[model samples]
Target: PPARGPLGGWRKVPRYNALCTLYHESAQQLKHLQLQLAAKEATVRELRGSLARQQQQQQVGVGEAGAEPARSLVESLLEQLGQARERLRDSERLSALRVEALSQEVQKLNQQLEEKNAEIEKMINQPPYEKEREILRLQKSLAEREKAQATSDVLCRSLTDETHQLQRKLASTAEMCQHLAKCLEEKQRKEKGNSDDQIATERSNQVFLQLLCFVHVLLAPEAFDSRDTSSRFRVHTGNQNHMHIQTKVEHLRGNSPGQPGARRTASQSEQTSPPADNGNSGSEGRAQGELRCPHCMRFFSDELSDEFLKHVTECCQ
Candidate 1:
């Protein structure tokens, strides 16, 4: 037999040897019985031939006195032959029983041999213990990997939820920032409009003060009297003062031409101008052509002395 492992085939060798020895011993016993039966058959045949010879001799010497002894011998031979036949029958029976038992023993040994062969084949195909242990180790590693995968899946889900929440917060913050920016822009625009209105009002007030000074200088004749030394000095400088007033009027007109204050001042100047004097109508007409309100760009007659002052007051407000 071929060996599958060091001990696998060696362990069965003793039993195989014992079975083979038993079979050989049984064959030898059967052969011995057969030889004994052949010997007994030959002996019985020899005894029958010898008895026939004795009977022939007795027949030939029928009247002799030795016939009695011969008859006694023949009787003894027949008895011996019957005993031999009985012994042969007994031997045959014993041999048949022995052969039957041997056959049954051989059959049982054959069945046992077949069973041993099947066991040997099974052992040959089976894996070794080391391979079985390796398979167990691999299965354990696979289980650990599956556990790690499950944990990773859970972590991924949590991270995904966090990312979604952060995105929503960012979107809300952006919207709030946009709203704040729009409110700040509207406030700045309103502040700028108020500042512009304040600056225009200041300019209008300064123009009104300048117009008042010009009107006072033009209408107040006592300030230009030549009797006093200070009045004579003022009369010498009146032309210069007139030029300065004209420059101021042109400046104010250019600076704020289309203001609502200017429109109100024009209407007031129209209402305040006095009627022309019949005696001095020609001189008054020439003077009116020369005098004008800077705020409304309207000429006035000299008889309307306080009209410019009243128009400036109304227009500046």
Candidate 2:
């Protein structure tokens, strides 16, 4: 009678049991969606890892390793890598869209529920016989909702575990990639593969290291002092490892976190963790790890891209 069909009708139709069942069913659907989200996230992570490995392999080439060729190849590969990264960005956009849609669904359901409650007020005033029927219908629907909710809870729990595990895997893979790159560089050097070429490769590696550091700083400014200015000394030394990170996170600088500015000494700044703790340490760790971009005077990860984007958007607006 309330006209919203199943949602509103379930309130006055004397099918309490059915209403319970429907609620449970909706809950189940919510859970299924959560699981789907988790699965998609996992897939994205796998894609990132696979792409990284492929890029590395390409950088190394088919065989007979010399550093200059490798370096030039790496530069070339970087351009291709950028395209892959753009693809990943598109995937991220899709995930964001899904999140938005799901949020809208939740909002709509809440509104529908409020409307049902209003209708229930009218039902409560009905004659006893009809009221009893209405109550029973609601009871049934409620039961269904409960069951659905339970299923959803189960799915969400599974997804939480999977995401945590996947995050760990991502961290490990980044570390491994860093190590592999280093070993390859050293191996090429040891073979005396080509000094001129080796020198060029070192230049390329240095440039990569600089970019890595820049990105890290943008992502995890708190992990390293943004005030340190001895760029020459800071790049090679691990002394600033204990300093607190600062940020005006430089995402669009085409700049790495390892800018000459961060190398400056910040004797006045406290070396404490961020008190306004945002849950970014995992990403921070990825940025900080010496292995991934060890020569980094500062590092930023793509994770900070969101925060940086938000900041810039606001500033421009």
Candidate 3:
């Protein structure tokens, strides 16, 4: 009945239609796998481009302190990429095995249909299937590349966010430092100003005290007596005779040192002319702390005697 040997195998082949169904399912799975691979490759390419741009920006943006974290992130990304590539390689190996198995089945089918060799040869000669497999392979590779690129892109974005946050923090810190420096400078300036003012005030006080000492030295009764050797001066007798005493003091100043004895004798003669009662009263009045300024023709009561002395010194000068 059925042809023997090689042709007889076709009778068993129909009974094993499930094998063809298995082959079709495998082809369908391979197509899906290839599509998945293509998508992964596209994702990888996009990610790679983004990662490169981000790396350039990162180099410009970060300093040594910031570089530490960015380097860590990049290291982690690289590790993940390495793992992904390993998985992709494993998938590729598995896909190659599956394709090899499908090719063996095709060869077996060709052997079983020896009488249909010409038709099979024509089918094999058609480029469409080979082209489809090539396209699917290319898509799978592209998908793997794309998957890797996407991961890199995500890592880049995260790093960029971190960089921006750090930059903002650094800027704020710098502003605070500037503010503190300004405050310190202002405080120092105020302290310096206060010190300068204090020094100036002390200098003025010292000058004033020295001036007071000089004035005291100038106004001393001893100083006047030492300078006017021609005059043997005594206190005025009374407030009533202030004008007469002032006139005599002026005449004494005008006289030469040679007339000291004659001036003293004249002063004693005038003093004796006063009545005894008047002289006693004048003496009592002199005891009461009264002062007269010969140069200014002014008299001062006891309360104003200190000021009167200062004024007399100035007038004499």
Cα lDDT tens digits, model 3, 1-317, are 22344224355566346556766676676677667666756766666666676677778995333322365665665676667667666766876787677678767775656655545555556689786998899999999999999998998888677556544544543454345445434544544555534433232222222223333333444433423654323323355334543333332232222335535533543464323233345644564344445444355654564576577667656
lDDT by residue (175-282, candidate 1, tens digit) is 543454454345445445565454343433333443454344433444323244533112212454345434443333432333556545433433443332354446
**TM-score of each candidate structure, all chains considered together:** 0.29, 0.24, 0.24
**Model 3 alpha-carbon miss at residue 205, Å:** 99
Q: How does candidate 3 fare on TM-score?
A: 0.24
Model 2: per-residue Cα lDDT over 1-317, one tens digit each? 34453335454334434444655565565566566556655765666666576678888884335542345655565566566556656655665666566566656665766678677766665689986898899999999999999999998888677556544544543454465456545655554644544433333343344333433333342323334564322221122322322211111111222334322222123123223224444644554422133233234343454444344333323
Q: Where is model 1 poorest over a 10-residue stretch in terms of lDDT?
A: 230-239
Best by TM-score: 1
* Candidate 3 C-alpha error for residue 141, in Å: 70
| Model 2 stretches with alpha carbons more than 4 Å out | 1-129, 188-317
Clashes of each: 0, 51, 23
**Lowest summed lDDT over 10 consecutive residues: which window, candidate 3?**
202-211
Candidate closer to the true structure by TM-score (higher is better), 1 or 3: 1
Candidate 1 overall lDDT versus native: 0.52
Q: Candidate 1 at 261: error in angstroms?
A: 99
TM-score, candidate 1, is 0.29
Cα-lDDT of candidate 2: 0.47
